[model samples]
Target: MNAPFGARGTALVLPQPYLLFLGDTTEPGFAKTAFGLRDWAGDKCVGEFALPGATVTTHLARMTPAQAYAEGARGLVIGVANPGGMIPPAWRKSLVEALEAGLDIVSGMHVRLGDIPELAEAAALLGRRLIDIRVPPAEIPVANGRKRSGKRLLTVGTDCALGKKYTALGLARAFRQRGVDADFRATGQTGIMIAGGGMPMDAVVSDFEAGAAELLSPDAAPDHWDVIEGQGSLMHPAFAAVSLGLLHGSQPDVFVVCHEPGRTEMLGTAGYKLTSVEEVVELTILLGRRTNKAIRCGGFSYNTSALGAEAAIALMARESDRLGLPVADPMRGGAAFDALVASCLA
Candidate 1:
């Protein structure tokens, strides 16, 4: 398939074309990279390559590494963000096969691919590059709680994989289409890969995580909108600190809460019940007020991929009316997002 034009009607271009490897799992952790790529790098994605006997997710189009290479793909991206951030042994063979075929590798896992001797040797022999996206930045200073000029909008979630980055990107796109000077401030690997620059918050030392956000959105023109991508969740058992740090560092003028419609629990944790969207919004606003007392809840981005089109639209409407705020699925195209952007920036 050909690359599609972005919102500005400009053709999308990548430094190097690649295919994403999602293996057999389409769970939230494993499938997020592919979804992010599709949303931001649509033209650059040749197709997804899955493991043998793996079931492809309904939304992603599947193709073999060879097929992708035939169509100008030069690398394979390890797209899963599994628990523990380690590559599964079952996926080793497929990765090796791709290396043997001269495809470079890119991964965001905590386990660096170049650290594996065999994989390193294969890449060296094939003269291919192995990019590990989770590597910590060289020098991240502490945050001083300094103020910035532009209007900042942050997307915080009730849990990981709840589409914070997607929501941020969607709003940035919407703002741009409306002739607003909006920039997406990515804070994770997948988001960095798409935006071409961002600190990987999880890899940074705890003290510097918030500092990274402070540096990312340094004073821009007052007309600019810095749509900062959030990481983790305030209520998540595993990564709450990181989430709080980002919230405090961004000090957004407005924040949006993102949630999945059918989710009942925090991912990767047992017995942790999911909080209602209203509760999550209130908690985020309360926390954000420590940095900016005037911080407000702009809207919500509800993930309704599991539902039919009609059902999703109906659900969005009901939530919007009940919460008295705009609601939308970032992946589903609609004018609701336009309203959300306006409300947040106004």
Candidate 2:
């Protein structure tokens, strides 16, 4: 993969099936997101490796990186749910091995290649550029100069990991369940993932309406209830204010919050510390209130325990009610989530 950064023009030779690094078990259990991606790909080709209980040092040392690379693999997606224990030099060497094998690297969480000193040369090895997602909040232009209707609105966010995809998907799914002619799309990561994988224009546009367009334009899809996901935390340097700005700009009828309780204190790659769920929620509340958009429901990671789910749903509900919004009860499944959305519009 030759990297000249920008979402403009990207090409992949499909070197092998996508290789996903699941990171440590503390990253929200990985059940729902993994299952979703697995189903989306229609194959169980994702490679799951266990990170050391406290650090990635041991894992990086015993590497035959070439062994992980598949000649047919399309690219590699490294999920650094935790970076606390990561050894920069060791991790950098492993990444270099993967690049030498001709693998296009896609990183998530706090795996910023450019941030580490040892990895500078390695970062340069694969076109000398890392994929940095930095979308800021802006207003979307309406098509044909049509003004937006004030009443019905929709919004969504991620509570844990990249659960924003699920939140966005659930909203779109809920809209369809209600027979509402709505479409789905995501701006940041998911959009790039789809477009890079060769998704069609209509689908991409629809996906954006579902979740991505809200960041840039307030009226990205005024006629349709758009459900978009937030990248990570405000504290995250690479994370942009634009993601949340999109939801505010759209003036969503309701905002759906998705999160994983397990990620509160996850140990990440390269010994970098990550914020907890409680901390993240605090940041989220600050950002959520930044725009006039109101949160309608809160969705938890699939791995949330029954009791944990109940408590989270209740806490979110109380918060929402305080804000005059509604919270979704996960026990009712996706349909229940959808019903809550429809009620919000009512």
Candidate 3:
């Protein structure tokens, strides 16, 4: 169970094998949630359910609510984000249909799923749940900046939605594969859903953001490793607070800076250029030292998905040699990934 606020646990347990719902999303960027689920938690996804005119697809078999329900899907996760996180009127019928088909609705929208009259009423009538993942706990404590026990590795990024969550997940999995006890601590809606529990770091109050991070990774066994999911970039003008708070609160002994290879500028921010890997490392250590004096860089997790095989390998090698730190694209695990994993444990 996840303790989203501070120390207490969650009742946000959602049903498994989700049917991703992309409601008329035409643009690929708008369907990030759907794509994330497919990429990270593909096994838990039964199929996709999209409304009419949705060009964006997960490439999974398309299924309606009835077909998805029959295929054993228990939840219909709202997989597209509009400008305001508001549910359009056009999406209600599809949501209600899912409820009638016995699949609960899971959403990460700013607006509550249960607050929407049509979806709420349908769920109430069908005895199905309307899970809203973005809601913070009732009470959250202010950060005390107290350091906790055990080892923690947090993933920091150059910008949002690159590969922080992916790297954390991959690292945690690799750690466990080597018989090391590690857990992936999720911090966002997509990650929270995938991990089955997590602190909604962005949803937390500014004062309690650090406190929530503290509770999110409490004192564990000395050998245990909590691989915490990273949030926004420190250089990002809008969302640096959450990143700072998580850094100060988690008090990680090691941190990995995640970055995309081709991003010239920060995602969604035109004029602001993406911070260099070297600069990110320097700033992370400077700011992160406030909470954990022994804090150090683990390595780099590069999103080299867009690069060719040879180019990706070459880039990773060049960066690793220059920085004197292991650099690996976790998706292409090799000697580089092995070295990266070794640095984390070292």
Candidate 4:
């Protein structure tokens, strides 16, 4: 989830029913995170705990897994201060205490791969795997709306801060200009909207309005249509995989992925780095199809330079097309994106 945007604030009681705990309760972004909780839960959640300064012992003692879960914690999004945060001498005992309480644990960015074993015993006892949020950050609730009549949906992503949202918004603007009824819905933190800039939540307020419209009319232009802008592959969990799952549920008609040339070239093929463009692409398509999901075009997130963006988008298109799939046409922007969505419906 996003930290505070404009100003530094403490926790705000979120209206939403679900809660995701990031770092210690005192982190800079705690309040903003609480705001996200309220947004997602729609003002149903009691609120979240930041747990700063509170030792694992005191923290777990108060909440007690049984109490927390019984109070309606469907899932627990846990982010350690760090990997070592789990095994530290003081925390070890408290960790054990919380685990014994039987709370299902889901890991956020703070819980890396190497830290898996740190909580293994607790995880097994809890009867749930410590979900890897980094793979896609958050567990996207299946998109709940009228299914897209189309078949294609473009998905865009970049290594980290490569401007994925702007590219997605640009595509949305392109399609809207073409009269293709597009709404840029962001699926992750940047899109969840809290504060300053980057994927504003105001962008997706249309969903709320659409919900109101559906309740009122049941059938006007499906409220809004076109596009769903999303965050990049960093920050949260299984970014691509989770996004694809969301697409499956929403049934977007096309796909466009954003790629950064310099990053995609070097990191795209590497296995160890989540930055691998190729790995992300292959894994995304494979999992999407395997799960019977949607994701036709895998577009690239390019820099402002037309030449670089065009080249990367072209290469991705060629490679994806060679493999018989949809890829963004960097040079054609609006036409290419519109065509992909059109093709999905056809």
Give the number of the best model, judged by TM-score: 3
Q: Predicted candidate 4: what Cα RMSD to the true structure?
A: 13.8
lDDT of each residue in 1-346, candidate 3, tens digit only: 2223223453246687899999999999988888888987888899998888989999999999999999999989999999998999999998999999989888898999888888878888889998888887666678788878889999999999899999998999899899998888989998877776677899888988898888788888899899999999999998999999999999999999999988878877758999898899999999999999999999999999999999999999999999999999999999999999999889
Model 2 clash tally, residue pairs: 48
Question: Which tens-of-lDDT digit does each residue in 1-346 have in candidate 2?
Answer: 1111123222111223555544444545332333344444324233543335523321222223355454244455554433353434434555555666655565433445566665456657565334433222223232232234433333333322545555555555566567665545444444334323211111223224323333222343345554443444444433334444344444444545454544543223343345543454455555555444343334332324444656665665564455443445433454445545656445
Query: Model 4, poorest ten-residue lDDT window?
Result: 8-17
Per-prediction TM-score, please?
0.78, 0.49, 0.89, 0.38
After superposition, which runs of candidate 4 have C-alpha atoms over 4 Å from their true positions? Answer: 1-154, 188-224, 234-245, 264-271, 274-279, 289-295, 298-301, 304-346
Candidate 4 residue-wise lDDT at 216 = 16
Q: Which candidate, 1 or 4, would have the higher lDDT against the true structure?
A: 1
Query: Which consecutive 10 residues in model 3 have the weakest lDDT in total?
Result: 1-10
Ranking by TM-score: 3, 1, 2, 4
> Which regions of candidate 2 are displaced past 4 Å?
1-17, 22-45, 49-72, 83-87, 109-111, 115-129, 134-166, 176-225, 230-244, 253-327, 330-335, 344-346
The best candidate in terms of lDDT = 3
| Per-residue alpha-carbon lDDT of candidate 4 for residues 152-226, written as tens digits (9 for 90 to 100) | 244546544455555555555555565665544444443333211222212223324223212211121543444
